[model samples]
Target: MANDNKDFFERVYQVAELIPQGRVTSYGAIATYLGSSRSARMVGWALNKCSSWHRFIPAHRVVNRKGLLTGKHHFPGGETMKELLENEGVQVEDNQIVNFNEVFWDPSNELL
Candidate 1:
């Protein structure tokens, strides 16, 4: 189980790195792309632990299915997630992405 968790977490970081600066994907989408459709929460858990990584993972680009910044609290400073996305040109209001579909990037489709 330990090795499985580490492997899955590494995959999550790899996918998170692929998300475009101004786009976002859901935790579920990453899970499904990794062929672990039932592990959306696990994906989130992996991203939450990404601070230990040697390189930037851009975990801020991953959001909830509804485009809600549900993991905003994990980004260290308050509003850091929102700030990162906004800096990428993704608008946010009330902690929710405004034009979600336009900015949504699905790994299953966007990636091979």
Candidate 2:
């Protein structure tokens, strides 16, 4: 069970790292790519603990299905997630990514 979780988290990191600059993906998207669409929330949980990871994971590039920055509060400083997205040239309004479909990056379609 521990090994399975470790592998799952590693897979999540790999997919999250694949996200291109100025693009974002959803927890559900990453979970789906990993063949665990039901584990979307788990994906977010794994990312929350990603600070301990040796490599830098662009966790800010992940959002909810509605393009909402649901995990923003999990960041150290307020607006950190928003700042990261804006830095990548992604427009954000009310904590929601504008033109979400345009910026959305799905690992399933992209990694193939």
Candidate 3:
């Protein structure tokens, strides 16, 4: 009766919650933590539709595998997702993550 699978979206948010203010994670990283690499796109879909949960999820902190800000359209200003990230200390250049290896947050290891 719990509709366990229905919580995939919630699980996605839980993972997002683990991303620190000045760091970021990939959609694939979050999907893998949820036990399915194939779910990365689904994770993106959930974030795109998460209009009410934006404040809680920090959906702005998630980017593509290559660290590209591919979800910019979903942001409230429609183009400042990168600016928001920059404000959080994430260095974005040419629409790609700079020093990705350093700023990446692996929730599996970093978060309890």
Clashes of each: 0, 0, 0
Off by over 4 Å in 2: none
Root-mean-square deviation per candidate: 1.0, 1.0, 2.5
How well is each residue in 46-103 modelled by candidate 1, as lDDT tens digits?
9999988888899999999999999999988889999999999999999999999999
TM-score for predicted model 1 compared with the true structure: 0.97
Cα-based lDDT for every prediction: 0.94, 0.95, 0.84
lDDT for residue 26 in candidate 1, whole number 0-100: 98
Clashing pairs in 2: none
Q: Write the per-residue lDDT of candidate 2 for residues 1-112, one digit (tens) a residue.
A: 3888888999999999999999999999999999999999999988998888989999999999999999998899999999999999999999999989999999999999
lDDT of 3 by residue, 20-71 (tens): 9989899999998888889889899878867776466788899998889999
| Candidate whose lDDT is highest | 2
Off by over 4 Å in 1: none
TM-score of each: 0.97, 0.97, 0.87
Q: After superposition, how far is residue 78 of candidate 2 from its true place, in Å?
A: 0.9
